[model samples]
Target: MDEFTSEELLEQLQQLDEQPRIEAKRASEIGKSVMQTICAFANEPGLGGGYLLLGIDEPSSVHESFTVCGVTDADTLLNTLQGNCREQFESPICVKGQVELLDGKKVIRLFVPELAPSAKPCTFKGKFDSKNKRKTGIWRRGLNGDYECSQQELEPLLLAKSGTSYEQIQLADAHWDDLDLSVIALYRTLRSKVRPYAEELQASDAEMLYALNLVRKQQDEWVPNVAGLLLMGKPLALRRLLPSVRVDYVRINGTKWVEDPEHRFATTLDLREPLLRLIPKLEATITDDLPRHFRLKEGDTQRSDEPLLPHKVIREAVVNAVMHRDYQVNQPILVVRYSNRIEIRNAGYSLKPEATLGDMGSKLRNPLIASVLYDLNFAETKGSGIRTMRRLLKQSGLAAPVFVSKVIENEFVATYLLHQLLGEEQLNWLTQFSHLHLTDDEAKALLLTREIGAIDNAGLRAITGLDTLSASQVLGRLHHQYHLIEQGGASSATYYQLAPQLQNDDQLPLFSGEAEASSEPNTSDLGTDTSDLGTDTSDLGTDTSDLNPATDTDLPEKLSQKIEQLTPKARRDKLWPVIVWLCALRPYKAEELATQLSRKETHLKHSHLNVLREQEKLIDYLYPEVINHPSQAYKTTDKGTNWLKHQGIEIE
Candidate 1:
């Protein structure tokens, strides 16, 4: 682990709360929670392990700051921690511990180094659940904290231990015929254009595929692996084999998501072609739908029409989504086109940390797929895609794209606003805040939050060209001093949105009431036949009447039964799914949810509600921008619904 002093560690805890590589515990004595964190630090693949500061308490809602509650018996705590590390796991782990003085008190600083790949998956000795095959004692670090892994979540660790990737796995039912010859030929043609004498081009089909590691011999016959099927599989084969591996392009008439069944979307198209053909088709579909601007170059007689968003920027965004997406997920990539922005939501979070997204290195989840795209000049192999997009968007005078990478949710969303960062209308909006005498950068930050509904340090840095510290300070002033914005989330996941007073009437509709009052078709006109085109037209409406606190007579039977069986002593994990189900039925206030669950309101908000909404991305505030609104409540998001489906829990 990188070296750091006690002073530096304390500073991090105070400023950023908890980080991926740092944890604070008031461990007067070593316990299960501490041991789990140690295991997580050791097992996380690329974390390089983390530091645990004993005798420090995490910031709570009441505290609002980390407190240094020094250790009472440092010698005893050290002995217990060391003993547990050696004897409690499947393999012995080596750690470094030291007793240090901070604020005139004693504390223990321990660093847990990540185990080697061959010795990974450091599971507890006797914690396996026999009844459930999915339960392993393995732990991995997440954005929220350490979490136990299910069998499905353990595949990456096992693959790393065996020195292989998911792409190299040969599917049992796959055959040589699953590969498309025409796509293979297209690859050869594209490769030749890049390199006329490429050695792979000189080889036959089987030889070429073998050279690319796309095919492996299994049971005396060469068959396509996951990478091969993803790159060149026929549409029919993909539908039969990997039915969820497709792209959905949705066009909406307004600026935000619509959940009403009648007018949720304007034009919907789903494409399941192979990557080689699919990329160009997606590009064309998006480019054709974008608003155009005419430009006449010097000495040209006729004007040329170009998209408002740079074509290069759009191409890079599309290519980056497919090239870096996690194929292990059973969900489709969604490209949503709103009136003012385009959002590409993919399954995988970035392999690199969100802070260093545009840094000069590549962290590949699917190296084989990325290799092909790189060779064809479809993507940058050195992590320059984001940088390229930013540069092109700047040249076009558009607001910098905002990227939200949620690790716990296992999702990433890239939002590109279609208008200039500070256009005439935006300047007019800024006039409202001129009496406060804000700086240019501060004004830009506020305007960005108004346009996109939220802004973070990274986003502020992207638009104003400020470093991390400066951007954070600007946001700090706006949130604390001026009170123009309200902050949500913690540490690196933190974000700020317009405060309740500043969420003016000019803001666009976030739900389906006034937004759908136009001449759009009603529920009866738009039939419920969504299966024909794979379009998701289901009514995910935010109707909260059934479970209203005023009359709680109409709860779904499954939900009602689950609520009736709840106990006060139940674990938070057990309550999480139930809470999601409840919110799916209707938005619920924190106090109301607490009363239903038989927990204290303050405890529920601090322990469960805040974590679910800010950290997990499972639930979101009903009035997100106006967070302190009188009727503020929590509702389930699409990610929360997907998580429920994965857990095999169905709510009618």
Candidate 2:
């Protein structure tokens, strides 16, 4: 009576290699790992818990396929699993299990529902080791698998259980002087514009901040909380206290991220001003760099100049980034301006599910920040930002912004393309595929995938105005019938990218005349036949060096020895440095790193790679523009190298 059957779960596992909600194991008896997964399922917030399929062996390295090894004692195994769930934890977890047959082999399908928030941070019944200061028994789901929670990692969970947001916590070290008085005055001015007779405007600075819940009294003195400092903190205070609480505006010279460090960015500006000043500054920075156009209205005497991107759209995007960002994460909000698009990457993922982003309800991660922004007319309280951005972009003849929210990675990226979605140039490109007789929506999906390097159901719906089901159907047709695209991920996480043939074909010039007129060097210019480009190999010299050196063979003796000394149950703090060292050598795909480290790919991604890249800024993506690129990999940045050197590790 589960929403998904064992067959469906198995198919997803086989296709995706792993899924957040599905775990398969050949269980002869209830074990530690099984209990840990159960604990993770029960405690992981927003996961809604997960499924455990017993008697199914995981895919092996050699075969890369899952095998159904039937369980001999399903009843006893089920009893033990249920018993452990009831008796082992701080609060009893009620898990449901049923025996199911798959591939003519018996398996136990158990669904563990997440516990209520108040009952969470579910630790095993054990003695507290105060001297060690370690969180021994609490478990949470990670990209690789269930891992014990570290003290630092448990803070958010503990806060959630107490119904206290990180933003509301009063900073003991922050005094009234930390908040900028000029910024508070600016807030008053903006508030008066929204409501001239607003009650808050009549109060003093301290009273106003208290009214906004920005400050709390401690030892009979008003102290700035996180929201207060974020909204009106002096630049020096912000730098000294919340160093990562700022915006990094980077201008890339071209459409893609350049790999060369010397020429990586054309301009870089870091702003640590208060949110009131920072939001407008960010918008102005982006607008000033954008290309402008002239538009003449009906009965207009003269044409009016306007930025290519609508001002309102830019405002909303900027406001949304700062308003709901997770302050606990020590990373700056990154705004990158490329030749063709603008990307805003923030520390926090959307509190709302990705599927429900444009829906009419708001889910605020930082309610205090959101409330302040709302009062000043900077943001809408009803979650109308996405909807407004889509409408404005559509009216302006621009593509709808694409949003990618990674919950496990704790990151959200909003990408706005500078050009029209299906302009004349794209139409000309579509002419080559006219023989396929694609529908208008299908064509849009294809063009979007090509432009962005990948497309998902949500992204397709955004561009083509299709419902979820219709968009999914169109993607399926492209993936299955036409074979123009291939699938990755599974279920709601599924995405489609152009097939290898189409990807290659799209890169080549469509017409012979165009190919001949191309300025770039070609085989024909080298006195070689154009037809020999694909087949000729004898003249191509071989370079034996590794293109991606994130392998066991490439690991340095120091790092290899360090890794060997670590146990399977080592803390993440101990594991992260090693991961950084391995990636420091060369770019490594998540799978490659997992293989080298003997961990699950998803676990490595969620627990280590993402933390390193997003929060720490020690590592970066090889193909940042296309996050789900086929050959996406991670590389250590200059910051990572410096961090290693600071730790007394020599780098080549």
Candidate 3:
């Protein structure tokens, strides 16, 4: 019974909207906004974790000028919405509906949370609605953005929600012996524990089976339901009954389409037995051994068993996928093995809203299947599988498992980082050189630059949760560490990049041997010698093609100082007019610039274009030789004349 006040909920709602993983509906309605926003947010990337504010108006205004336009029928709408949501959503949607008085007006704040990993994206109506169907469809949060689920995505996700197989139904021709006796025994053991009056009901095995709805007498013959056959039927019988409902397993070494895999296995396994077997085998492949003797004991006491994979964590993840996967979706569960990680992707999006992943509650999409698994000792009763996995991974010193629910694609993918496989060298490199001391926002900024090769301040601000000052300090640290090089200015005009010399030595040749000699006034300006890889040729492409060619002689003096002093943007902006005139004679591509200037690809992207635009020194010119619509080149602009004058260039 965690209680959040209306004010708290409003604050949370605002935070969510500011960084929503999905599309947020901008409105002030009470119940309708709550439900629709919850659904839309739930159908967002991770399924759940969203809010609906009743008082806040669209197009945010200052608080003093704000008005709280409350909902009509607040009480009645709250109850109706809660009841309807409970009935409609597969998982119990915990809603905090409250009325708050702001400026003497009553506003209802509804906080709809995301479902647990087990629960998937659920729709209110029992019809197909694609996420892109804007006017009609819905989807949960996906990694990239909101996307409509393909039929292949939707069916399995929905079927998994209830965790029931076709075998649950009583069949007309099946008998007790036709079912797997071992499976039956397991089921009985589970049922006894799950059911309260198991010992009191002194019924025979066949009678117990009948009461459980595994068997039924119809037209003078005993039959099983789809649920009965799927759960308790013999493997051969189950296959014959539902040939399409099978788990496909494929294992490959490395990550490419190339066929040079270290090992590969592909098979269609029976739902129950194969899952049980697959678990152990997957763990075996991912395991490695330590020295076996950390501390020398008297004799054999030094030996210990270490699993290659985090058994308990991976088991729960796989079990959740198997038991709760949408059985209706006939797609295969993919387990992609890579050199460093394992990706287990199942057919279904999370039913819970985005927020539930961080909370301490459970939501079951397939209560029946979950119950069956619980009895069989395959799963827990309290629904803490996700929490358990997280705890275990964290304890094992591995990165927290990444849980993602995509409603648009109708799938749930969990990534498990194999700490053992990362090796001491890789781990040392990542932890020591990875800038771990940096804040989460700072780390994110580094990652963005790493992935994209270049990043502007605005992009850094958006990705890293840093304020202006913090981001600047973080970027400065990266620059100081030689992990990143600044292109452009010290303030808003800056962009950051991985320094070429600091990058792998093998990559230095790509930027070429030509480099501008240190323009540093002395040892103080040149903080460190990064010239080990090669010479510093920062002015390789200086254009003597200035409108007043005589003014170009001054460029040599400007090139004398350290490159850091000539802010990346400033250098480009100041030289934009000269470069544009050079390009006017013969068009040059990005690669050409990089090759001619002896700068890395990263440096070119981070500094070149933005600098050209900053001083208004260049104008766009179409490439006459190319037939491309966007074919353009940079040329001298009228502003270049003034900029050259400012640089103290005299006109002849």
TM-scores for all predictions: 0.82, 0.80, 0.44
Please list the residue runs of candidate 3 whose C-alpha ends up more than 4 Å from where it truly belongs after superposition. Answer: 1-178, 185-203, 210-227, 237-244, 255-305, 351-361, 390-397, 420-437, 440-652
Candidate number of the best TM-score: 1
Off by over 4 Å in 2: 15-18, 61-67, 127-135, 259-262, 437-442, 455-652
The lDDT, on a scale of 0 to 1, for candidate 3 is 0.48
How good is model 3 by TM-score?
0.44
| Candidate 1 segments whose C-alpha is farther than 4 A from its true place | 1-4, 46-48, 60-62, 126-131, 258-262, 353-356, 359-361, 381-383, 404-409, 461-472, 489-493, 505-550, 556-593, 599-652
Model 3 RMSD, rounded to 1 decimal:
20.2
Question: Which is the leading candidate under lDDT?
Answer: 1
Cα lDDT, all candidates: 0.78, 0.77, 0.48
**254-365 per-residue lDDT for model 2 (tens digits):** 5555534455556666667899999997788777767666678899999776777899999999999998788997667878887667889887878787777889989999
Could you report the Cα RMSD, in angstroms, for every candidate shown? 5.8, 9.2, 20.2
Over 479-526, each residue of candidate 1 has an lDDT whose tens digit, in order, gives 989999998766756778889988865763332212332233222312
Give the alpha carbon lDDT tens digit for every residue of 1-652 in model 3: 2455555544433332123422223233334434556665654434336555565544354543224566666677677777877876545577766767755766666666665434765565654555543233344443222334445445444544566443354444555555677766666665666674674246766676676565776766566665566566676665565544444333333332122322222211123243334344434333321111122336775544344345677668667777767555444455555434456667666766433654565676555555556655677556678778878867666555655554444566665545422334333334645544765555555544543344544445444435434555667666775455555322222466656753432221111101111221112212222231122111111222332322224344433232225343555444454454444434454445455445665466345543453213243322211111122234433344455567654333
| Candidate 3 or 1, higher TM-score | 1
